[model samples]
Target: MRTALTEMLGVEHPLVGFNRSPAVVAAVTNAGGFGVLAASMYSPTELDAQLTWIEEQVGGRPYGVDLLVPEKFAVSDPDDLVASLRAQIPAEHFAFVDALLDEYGLPAHSAPRGEEDALDEIAAAINPAGAQALLDVTFSHRIAMVANALGPPPADLVSRAHADGVVVASLVGQRKHAVRQLEAGVDVLVAQGTEAGGHTGTVATTVLTPEVVEVADGRPVLAAGGIATGAQMAAALALGAAGVWCGSVWLSSEEDITPRPVKEKFLAAGSSDTLRSRTMTGKPARQLRSAWHDAWDRPDAPAPLPLPLQPMLAGRAWNRVHAAAAEGHPGATALDTYFIGQVVGGFTELRPAAEITREMVEDCTRRLRALGELADT
Candidate 1:
């Protein structure tokens, strides 16, 4: 309970929960774990409002903000990148999506939305400007830390955070990435493995966590990926992590905003059912292996558009598919999917965020005590 992360964030536990919902973030932080509200899914203005709302709800509890600043992204000039990527999306993809909808026998839209509107929606939804917007709000608020999910925080961003006296952290899938982030002057390293949900690397957590700890050179390292249980948290700490960065386990919790159908799919899914597919987002993100991934990964399928474009192409279709899935439509069910890590297999029930946080602490304490007794022997 008094580990470096808890001390750093002024929380009661070393657990960090990453979620997109503001409610879930507040709940986790109030429960003593550092709640990280993912900012990639909002525009700058929207993120500002969300962070402001979070500040009101959490009542000054220490929480953090997460941004997606990928080390390698398709866009060079953010604006031109958005524009060019918009033009590159083929109309055929729309046709395929429409046909899929028809197969589901869902109500057809009276008129199709324009490509620009669709593109702008997705870009705005996961735009980099959201990161800048969140930075502005976080620096203005009592945010304890700022994290970059996809890569090292940009130099300017990292500099700004440090200048504001906020601890900066980045997620890395490999030791090389950890070194790169450290050299960039990140305060903490999040060692995420392939078992993580969303974007992840291929390395297993059992091997990657210690490797990252070794490379961190005493900087705090949070082990991520495939760590849902308290025993898993204890294993991460025993493996040299200063804390645990958990995401997937929270998806099925009561505080989580994940839809019921999607949550059910995750609950029924095993660790092996998910796949690393680049079809949804431009980069490889692990999601429930559904017909959507299957359709996109087919040999004849067009290569996924770049970061903002691919999401642009799929976002509306996804929304429609998800709505249909909620209605129990067959075609929608084929495509309704969400990201969850391999630890999803461990998610046997839905509980409150506070209960989950408490259980993790209790279980971790028990496991560590057992290990200490073994050492005494």
Candidate 2:
């Protein structure tokens, strides 16, 4: 509990919870762990509203914001980036998605289709300009930190965050990436493993954590990926991590906003039930094995488009899938998958986020004490 992360983040426990729900974020922070809200899905205005609401809920407890500022993506003219990207999505990909829906026997979409709107929804998630806009909104608030969920935090973003008295953190899967982030002046490093949810590299946490810790040279390093229990947290500390960075564990928490059917799927999933596929975001991200991914993985299916386009195309389809699943469509239910880590198999119940944090910390404390007793003998 008294690691460098605890001191740096000013939290009683070094457990940092990252989630898309403001309720979950506030709950974790209020329960003595730092909370980081994922802001990549939100527009600047929407992010402002959510952060403001979180501040009201946590009542001065420290929380951070996470943005996806990938180091590289298909570039385009800022004035019409979405339009440019839309044009690049081949007809075969669109036809493939349509064919999948038809095969599922789902109801036709009743809502009007707006390609521009879909592109706009995901533009910030794939481009630096969109991330910059969100950062502009973030610096105006009383956030404790700003994390780049993907590549290194942009130099200007890091400098601005530092000037605003907020810590800058970046998630890296490779030791070399960790070195780059440290050299780029990142204040903290989240050494995430391939087993982590969402976009991740091909390194296991066991190996990646120590490698980053050694390269960190004493800077705070939080171990992430496949960590969902106190025993795992204790193991991370044993590996020299300042603490654990948890995301997927919170998805099964009571405060999470995951759809009911989707939550059921996550609870039933095993460690091997997930796959790293670009079907969701273009870049490889771990998601529950579902018919959606199965269709995309077929040898004949059109290869997924690159970043932004892949998400843009899939985002609309997912909206339909969720809507139909809510209305009792079996096929839609089969396609309802979300990003989750390998630890998802342990999520047997929907407990409160606060309770999850407290229990994990308490268990970790007990384990450490028992280890100390053994050392004394």
Find the candidate with the highest TM-score and give its number: 2
lDDT tens string, model 1, 93-123? 7777677677667668543557446446546
lDDT of 2: 0.89
> Cα deviation in Å at residue 249, candidate 2?
0.4
Model 1 residue 20 CA deviation in Å: 0.6
* Residue-level error in angstroms, candidate 2, position 282: 0.9
My TM-score estimates for the predictions, one after another, are 0.92, 0.97
Worst 10 residues of 1 by lDDT: 122-131
Q: Measure candidate 2: CA RMSD.
A: 1.4
Off by over 4 Å in 1: 71-83, 110-130
